[model samples]
Target: MHRLPPYRLRRSARAKYLRLLIRPEGIEVVAPDGLPESTVLAFVRQHSGWAQAKLAELQARLAKLRQGQAERFPAEGGSVPLEGRETPLFIEETGGSRIRVSLEDRGLRLILPRACGAERDRYVRDALFGWMKRRLPGRVAECVQRHGPQHGLYPRQLRIKSMRTRWGSCGPANDVNLNWLLGLAPPSVLEYVVVHELCHIRHRNHSRDFWELVSAHLPDWRQERQWLKTHGGGLIQRFDPVFP
Candidate 1:
């Protein structure tokens, strides 16, 4: 009723029905090609009530993720969610200007030079981002090993980085690109995404066959998928250190 929250209308030739995807930033309406704009507009307006409620919940979740930035990074009591649990951060001063970052079983460790206090936060962010980049490829390989053999599916190459719109994508050649921010999510969530992309290598679209393939490998994938739909946006919007 209130003019509907912000929305972007995407016309997809492959889209069979109008779909509404709600995220923290706004709404995404995927409409079949050649559909009338008026029809799309009406469809969105029809779901205004549901969309509003979903958006409110997402906004609140993101706000909680942003609380006490000091407790998130580059300060005392810093923590981050890793593998579905809050992982604490610890920093130790080294004698040189270089920063050393490593992931221990206990938590993330940052070795920063005492003289770099003026720019510690920036340096820590960069180091942690690098660690994220390094962390994802190994995980993807592990997922492929666990799920790819029987199906004979493997990626041409794996490219990991911080992506804004999607968690992962499979190229025509089956080279996979994954968003590093996914590392912050639960391990199951990450595997679901990896499996989703791997399926794309065989079936380019979201056909029944593709979904069957996914279900064959991950029977509980629907739960992880739902988790991403509900919490993934906040991971990208509020918890991505590069953006923060």
Candidate 2:
């Protein structure tokens, strides 16, 4: 008889019988009543090596993900990838209580309060992101006023969300939600995103009507869209905003 990989078995009253499920995490075994001890032991004996190999693969992938997360931010005197090159961040102590981030002398400058410590990195990151969050609503409102009337589309409500995967989203109810991270992109990209969401007010899906609406307000919207798509990973990766 052909051998199968070793797997754990869990008893569930709701289960009809023995079941197998394969997932990215691993394979699972479920039995309604119970599996015989001899059968379980035999299964393990038959494919112990395969099980061990699968377990090792999963652990390696997890280790890589954890390592990537830690290395997301560069160390002092180290550089982080920005645009197409590695850009260095110059940290300085300033008298101001609030932290500020600005581009200076071909490098990114982070001016932190004099009271800074190990916690200062998270604090400054939040401070800069908070500024973006605070300004997003007004920027959306302005975009609505400028483009809404022209397209005969208006948002019932505008909101900001800390979404992980999108620049903005529109609802069937005409509500608009913009990703707080959009503020990190260049100004034109932000405008393109705003217009994109407002266009959803008229067309919910990415249909011809939607593209037409987006083009009507922003003729060069496609270029900006491409720029953001290619460069957006840097925006979220740059801050690694610590959520409280």
Candidate 3:
């Protein structure tokens, strides 16, 4: 018999069924307060396959983090990947009070007040996120409009959010919700996610028919999917504070 790996077990007073959390720290097993240790062990054993897979995934993520796969906080001379390329970031202090950002031939340029103080990091993050908010909506709308019609799949609405666990989701009402962080990925990758959710409008489940619809629209979707699987975590982690 295969033995389960070492994990920390905890008893919750709220009294719920067994819940397992695989995090960067480690695996945690949460069970009802009165549940027998043997039962908890049995539960872990029952889900050993899933637990092992999740552990491997998390370990890979941690390894990527250690390798610095993405830039958390970009400085004046630093560069960030934008639209499939490593775009340089140029930060300059201007005498004006307002902060301005623009895309140049080499990369992105930001102009901030010379007297900008402790709030610089927040200002930069906000400026970048605001720029993405303004830009991504139109891009997503264009993708949906362009591809949705071809497949006879139309979504009633489109929403952008900072999703933690998913790139995008399609609701039963034909609403497509996309992760704003996708703007950091290559254009093809973003398009794949949009097409994926749009296909869900036709088939809500991940059945064979659903994937067939996706491939019909985006034949290179598997490559894009692999790109996200390899790079998505770094993009999602970009929101974490680098200074603090």
- Cα-lDDT of candidate 1: 0.83
RMSD of 1: 17.9
Per-residue lDDT tens digits of candidate 1, residues 64-141? 877745444546457667776778888888887877877788887888888877677767666767888887788878
Candidate 1 clash figure, as a count? 0
User: What global local distance difference test value does model 3 have?
Assistant: 0.83
Candidate 3 vs. true structure, TM-score = 0.64
Model 1 residue pairs with clashes = none
Query: Which residue pairs of candidate 2 clash?
Result: none
Candidates, ranked, TM-score: 1, 3, 2
lDDT of 2 by residue, 1-244 (tens): 5555646667788987555554456666666666676665565566566666777788788889967756555445545443235667677777868677675676766677878776765765665556566667787777778888996888788887777778888888988888776766666787888899888877778998889888889999989989877877766675654444
Instruction: Evaluate model 2: give its lDDT.
Output: 0.71
